[model samples]
Target: MTRSANEYLKRILLSPVYDVAVNSDLQKLDKLSASLGNDIWLKREDQQPVKSFKLRGAYNKICQLSDAQLAKGLVASSAGNHAQGVAYSAKKKGVKATIVMPATAPDIKVEAVRNFGGEFVDVVLHGTSFEQAKEEALRLSKEFGYTMVAPFDDEDVIVGQGTIARELLEQNPDLDTLFIAVGGGGLISGISVFLKQLKPDLKIIAVESDESACLQAAMLAGKPVPLEHVGIFADGVAVKIIGEEPFRLCQQYVDEVITVNTDEICAAIKDIFDDTRVIAEPAGALSIAGIRKYLRTNPMQGKKFGGILCGANINFHTLRYVSERCELGEQKEAVIAVKIPERKGAFRAFCELLGGRAITEFNYRYSTDREAHIFVGIKLREGRQELAQLTESLGSNGYNSFDLSENEMAKLHVRYMVGGRPPSLLNEKLFSFEFPEYPGALMKFLDTLGERWNITLFHYRNHGAAEGLVLAGFDIQDTERGEFDQHLAKLGYIYQEQTDNPAYKFFLSDVNGVFEK
Candidate 1:
């Protein structure tokens, strides 16, 4: 008998399937490539009517089956893409396809399978995850006399997926790299084999979301290893363990594997829409995100590379989060925690410091003492650093501050609560400054705000040292210039006019153009 490994390689090499699963026309992505600062192309597997590259493997595998096997029908399990592929392929081959999908699978996916004439068995959604659904599917396939079509582990499936590499090379003979999203590693395995045979110099990079980096983790362990936990954020590539065969093929033919965080993948999704006007599910854009990250760190410069936008089966609601998080990842946004003493004039004084920034969220936390924590979400200026220096200026006058950007739970919940007693006295001053970010920016500001005024409210967090937003309030007996502008000017910090309008009420009924209470 032919070695399964060799047979798989030959079968994929001879797949009578589409001459190529990924073509050059489909490979080029103007939007995806431009972000890389290189000539990058996208193998548009998402363009498939089924909305994924899964069809390549599904059809190729089924076509190679004997007539008797086809007559016996096929059984498969999938949450989305693979299910669509098997259903579509079975309909094309005039075979019955029974798909066992968890009740939790997206309704859209179930509909698509039904549209392709695949019978759906809605199983008990008792399992904690999709992999459990597959286990049930496997047991049912055996009981029902149905041949199982493994999504990415089977030799036939790998060969079919390899067809993508064959076509990609044919389209761009000069292409130096190919980025494929890894789940069970079938796509990478097939492409690695074909690409290495045709072009030994081609760099095959596998992109996997960190949550489901089964193949990458396996390679690291030198064997298939299951994840104790997996994040379903990118469902398509969320495999617990990479198939043993695919792993061996990967160890032999794959060049490199990389993982991307969910945030990074979300950023890439927005980037793709900005370029291609197309929305890709997180899993579909995994390779594109990886390639973008690679070129960002490696500088492809004038080289040509290819990324596969493999699927578009995203749930519509996820796009909202993907867009919002992408903006945050780009540093165009931030949520801040502001500390202010419970004082009358302090709130108004701090309001004056917000010049160019737009407020997005404002919440107050209640406290028994005179001081309280204020959570505020604000748009950051293009080039701002940590908030400490700004807080230092306020601190000198009596304000102490800390950043909540690193506190995930605070950003999620605490940011919305605002509680504190009303101030009875009014003695505070407010001012905004642009200061040089240095080793002692905060301490210097503290010295400058002087020891006379007690700080009431303060908000500043450094992202880097270039520049930062400073919102602070000080309890000063008088509104005289004193060391206010002097210290700022000495440090090359500018006193910026923030709020001068008559419509907004001042926290401190101060007595000046920019301050007094």
Candidate 2:
């Protein structure tokens, strides 16, 4: 549909989202502004009734429903925030709501949905993915006559989200730029459409988690397309494809779309906590991450900048992972694997060569008396520059080193598991797999992957997300290569071969004749 920006503007002005949703404060980030040398402001959408701006869209969509439609009730599917929004809105309108959430949806979110709706909503734990849960919701809406309240694709929903833009302009009429987090694109579509229409020169930059940048993909493809793979660390914005309407609106109004990695999101999360004492979910902090990135390249002085803390429904355990990686995101730490001699005092000599720089981490397990591979982390004062200098310094001193700071596999799997060299060459093939996180998922994976092959090495970590990331190794003979290929094809999970990955070669696997072990 060709969305009329003016119509959205009119509806936004008249939106009744405030009935259940609060007009969250437009707070100034005094500390962030001072530190970044820019006037940064954050719209506290995390302060909404459901702790998300999603409540606005859900409530508005419900309000637009006719009395008969309301009586028929509504059905919606979401991994988190939208489910709570629909449930809360349904309760306010005295209508029944069936919220279908993936089985892997955060327990806190599921419980919050039930609490907000009281007896007015039924929480159905559906399939392992949003797509599956969404399919069930659609089936129920069609066959059972429930009104389907789309999470981000409907007109009333767009109007509801546009209310944020209305509030933003009102709060800071002279705001120079706005950074918005894009998932399905509803939030940015509404905000960008409204802001661009009102202030033609207002810059609207969309931010996305690099793992699931469906909007950025849409901008490239010129249409919404599904991403073959998507990471879910920032589950809130982990959409595989942008909504059709959202994509259309974004194509018209969005000036630029930038993607941030998990580390950057973690850094932004810390920045938000430091300034506002508010713990933003990974997706909630994307705007701040994007703002920092934009300023790094397009340096500005005292420019009025605005961003939204879209939600704060963070899983508690996730804070641990965030704490560990945030320093890397800020370029305050660098990890490198170095080859040091196994001779006595070799470790001490390496540390001394650094001139007493603080060591953040060091991992080494003696495998051979000839040489050793040491995984080391050191603080950085000049970010990547310092890292380059350190690497060069190590090379000049006859120490071979590899920078694994930007290597995803190294940071995620190898760092924690630095000591697992096969006893002998077992013809092992390493693979990194991503699968839906649910009960028995690991066992199921083992069942399918290890039934015919000998398991060699395995590493898995859960960051309180919808998916589990596993790095597994299997021993396969050359004669079984065809069968192994067939097995991998039969397994539908997303995966990438890591046999040649430097992290694995240096730390986990039996490589070369020398055994970098």
Candidate 3:
């Protein structure tokens, strides 16, 4: 028989063992509410023991297993939190649990799963993706007689997730909407059914990363479709396909599914960190991203809304990329990739055109094209129109430019492309200096150079430190070596001239310290 939403609600109401879940708080989001001009609340499932709502589902599912099934043991696959949830629940119920997780899963998650007493079957690095790992888990389950405890598809799991709704309504009965991150549609499916049954008019908005939007794709395709590729950044919710059971519930109960970019999700993570001093993993912070987009089109008119921070399992190496993109997403920083001729006077003219914006990164390369191209990064003004004028002026100066404001590749690796040029000649010069933190350091640096020789490459970082570092590359005109020496002496700053160093490589090398190797 097909399970009904009513049945899930009955399970929550009747299950005495699950009453503890009813105590989790539905918190008023004072800051987000003020920002959106709406009363926003958060179902703080991150406060749970496993640091996510996953525990609820795992506990519910494991508790409902028959004695024979429990004796047979259970297994599940997850990148992080789901594994911990299942492990914690199985240990509590005296059930033998074996978890299958990707080899790339975070060290903390792996440790946490072990801490919960779940035996881990470390599989061979078979698949390059999470879905393949999941398939392997299913195969192992069938072959080993272990019950497959799905992360989000089973009725018991949905009921466990729905318990969050029970707690949420008990605390804030007037909530008009709830935002929940959708991975395989388990959490949102459960919450949607519970919330819809309790308050028929309450809005359920499903938030997902655009690159890993399985539920949204499933809804649009009218069935579960395997995604050709899934983003690994939001590891927690980077599901390739929606669970068949949860998709049906989402279709019936979820009001809408909204997609957000990885950049937006990272920005939301930063926002949460700023407000609550809490560091959320990418998937954990995605629900707020939907609420932000929702406020753009629909004013809440002071109606109450809430979002759940689902899980935190971000990789440490990935944080740097997320930080850079989040700054761009919030418009606090800007990156531009421009191609300028490697000729005298052209470099100076381009720099002079950037009257007010600072230079964040300036690097050059010898392109295969006739003209050597240089990529200069500029900091944009706070006002959008001011930034537009700066780029327009760049275009006017016989240079072709592309904004890396939303480009993932450029932010991750292209900003450090400054070491491809051949060694400087006798008359060439290089200087590194610390400039005072200011609004127009780039423009000032150009003014100081005074339209002299061609600038071969430059790199600067304005990271709110005591001072910013500026590295400039110049092609000297037919001047003597004495003039170049005098120029460096006049600057009176600690510096290095790497033109003669054998460490120079055609591409970015470790010796140059220009790019991330």
Candidate 4:
């Protein structure tokens, strides 16, 4: 174990990170501080030229390479941020750079790398994941004479990341705790070594996504271990294994390791946006989410805490999922599945029980003669306790309800699959529509359609974009085709008929002749 805090301190001091990286601001988070009753500060590394802290380490490592190595150029593999970092650094150093990225990487990130590196970077999309891309990069490095740039494992990279801690301690010397997001563990390992040696009393906490928690796993086993499966939602920090060097540093200097779920990450994104008016990638928001959870469990009041806002290279399409889950993540919404009698007044009675809190989502289909299962989402004002009370109230009123708030299957799949084909429906036509996303746009759509035709099935989800996607089924006979066409023209929305879509046929079609409505 060649883990020397003093040696790391010297390396950090001499690190050439500043040549290509910004000394990011340490901004005070007033709203978060007021809510938690503590002094909260954010290390805004997301404001870097690459829109991530990765440039510091990448540039530092590249600058340290021998003249021969620089002349040969460099090769690296990254999911997104590190690729951008390497590309930008290589462009600045006037070296040829080849970045191999996962085919699954977002288009925005790939395009940014090309634009940032200009004539210096060659981006190759080869594999479906980072690990595979990394393997290809290594193969190419051997095949050619290009030097390989490790994303987070190398000593120079770790030292470069440590520079953040130097800035943090200088900016806010009174911090009691620091929260850092951990993937391959470079950032936390670097920060922990520097801060622990400098301020022995300061707490260093490592935050990781529960789906890809290699750091927590390594800490438990006392060695780096490969995770069998990793979630890709927070693709920036979705490492399957911790680096050996980073693991050793973390084992020695990191105070604690904690994991947060997808919802918590989404909620943290919302929190950051509220304060900084900036949306963070899920991985970037991991530290803030961990901080919130720590405050909940530890209840430290009036203490100084700092969280690193690591990166902000989020894909635009992912905002819809983040927005939809944020409310549930904050415990401000509860999704429940209820079984009500198929009679007409059961839905009305269930609404009465709800008492007008707010309906975020409601999906139902008459699938059976005796009972109908409805998936409903209600806006929560109080918290989880309100959800519990609502569940009890439903039972007392003779409605059978199952809380789906914590059910991952329900949230991701079943909610959208709420309406399957029923046995009695006649002349059902499925159509897809896109409307300008705005307040009351859905209501306007429904109002314009009116009660002229019975709605058999409907699905609409807001993806936090310019337009909203909707799938609808209506009972329209061939005789009423002309009238339906006129209604669509009057609505003036982009529409497509998906009645024959294979996905609908396989999963939603009442193939057993069970249609009864």
In candidate 2, the residue pairs with backbone N, CA or C atoms under 3 Å apart (3 or more residues apart, or in different chains) clash, namely none
Q: Write the per-residue lDDT of candidate 3 for residues 126-172, one digit (tens) a residue.
A: 24345656888888788988898889878888888877777788788
Q: What are the Cα lDDT values of the candidates?
A: 0.68, 0.89, 0.70, 0.85
What is candidate 3's TM-score against the reference?
0.74
User: Who wins the lDDT comparison?
Assistant: 2
lDDT of 4 by residue, 1-517 (tens): 5847899998998888888888999988888789779988999988899999999889989988999999988999997899999999999999999999877667788899999899999999876567779999999999998999898998888988999989998999999999999989889988988989889999999999998999999988889999986765787788999999999899888889999998999999999999999899998999899999898889878899899999999989889899889989888999887778899888888999998889999998674688777779999988899988998998898877767788664575457886766665468788877665456778977887688999887888765433456778888989999999898888877677877654344335554222120
Clashing pairs in 4: 320-463, 422-514, 422-515, 423-514, 423-515, 423-516, 424-515, 424-516, 424-517
Least lDDT summed over 10 consecutive residues: which range in candidate 4? 508-517
Q: Taking the tens digit of each residue's C-alpha lDDT, what string does model 2 give over 300-409? A: 79899999999999999899999989989988899988888889999998998786678999999675777888899999887888888888888888788888878899
Q: Model 2's lDDT to the true fold?
A: 0.89
lDDT of 1 by residue, 345-464 (tens): 766666556555676767765443576555666676651363444556556766544544444324322343234322554454555554444456667666765665567655565433
Q: Kindly give the stretch of ten consecutive residues in candidate 2 with the minimal lDDT sum.
A: 508-517
Better of 1 and 2 by lDDT: 2
Query: What does candidate 2 score on TM?
Result: 0.97
